[model samples]
Target: MKSEYILKTEEDTKNMAKEIAFDIKNKIIFLNGEIGAGKTTFTKYLVEAFGLKDEVCSPTFALENRYETENGLIIHFDLYRLKSEEELDMIGFYDTLKENATILIEWADKFNIEKYIKKYNIISFKIEDNNIRAVTIK
Candidate 1:
């Protein structure tokens, strides 16, 4: 079941993330958006909604950030700096998928989307206007 939502500001984006968080269960979510878009902001709210107390930030430099929540672990990945899919293997990407965790990936376009199609709920974010964003889920 796919869905679409419109967010007018950062707050709206966060709220939308919270709503989506409730429906997720051991799933993967791919967040696609441009720089300065609300991907990280949405992720922060999603983590919070999962009852995580730690701060949520972009993993651009760190590559990935893992948070342990009451439900399970949440793995956030930023592929902006990744040179190739081969690097994912070196970093134990497949190992992460072995766990019953929720994964949210940013800059997912850099990777092969088909690899995760069966296990992921894809969310694509697009700027509709200066203060508005359209998020589509499939």
Candidate 2:
């Protein structure tokens, strides 16, 4: 499935995230975009919709973060700083998918995830203007 939305403001982005949170099935999510394209921001709202009280921050340096939600665990990974695909192996990337959790990966381009992407949703963020974003899903 593919969908596109124009977010003129942060609120629009939030609304889109909320809708996706409830609509998207439990599967891996690959977020693709530039550094400031709001990939992390979109995941933040999705986590919020899952009943997380604390703020959601990117796992840039940490590599990953986990949020326990009523539905299940939400595993968010940022491979932006990953130097090689071997790092994913060291970090137990496949083990993560084996678990019963919703996985979302930012900077997924670091490695070839095509084999694991069949059941996943891909969301690409593009900055149209300041605070304006073009969000597309595939």
Candidate 3:
């Protein structure tokens, strides 16, 4: 399944994330976008939708961050700084997949992990000029 949304403001992104958070069954989501894209912003709203009050920050340096919510754990990962596949193993990336938690990965396109994951969703964000963003989910 795939859908697209034109986000004109931060509120639009928040609503979209909230909708996806409630509707999507797939816990593993791959966030594809470049720097300055709304990946982190969307993530913040998604976490909020999950009933989490903890602040959400990019795990660019920390590799990953985990937030426990009423539903379950929401693990957000950023592969932007990962140097190699071996680093993934070192960071216990594969191990996390085995757990019963919602997983969101940024820079997932850095490596081909689709074969390893049985079920997942891909959400791509594209910046259209200064105030508009095109978000597509599959």
Q: RMSD to native for every prediction?
A: 1.7, 1.6, 1.4
Task: Estimate every model's Cα lDDT from 0 to 1.
Answer: 0.82, 0.83, 0.87
lDDT computed for candidate 1: 0.82
Off by over 4 Å in 1: none
Deviating ranges (above 4 Å) for candidate 3: none
Displacement of the residue 65 alpha carbon in candidate 1, Å: 0.5
For residues 1-138, write the lDDT of model 2, one tens digit per residue: 339999887788788888888666467889999998888888888888888766889999999999998766889999998988788889998788777788899988778876765587889998875668888998
Judging by TM-score against the true structure, name the best candidate.
Answer: 3
Worst 10 residues of 2 by lDDT: 109-118
> TM-score, each model?
0.91, 0.92, 0.94
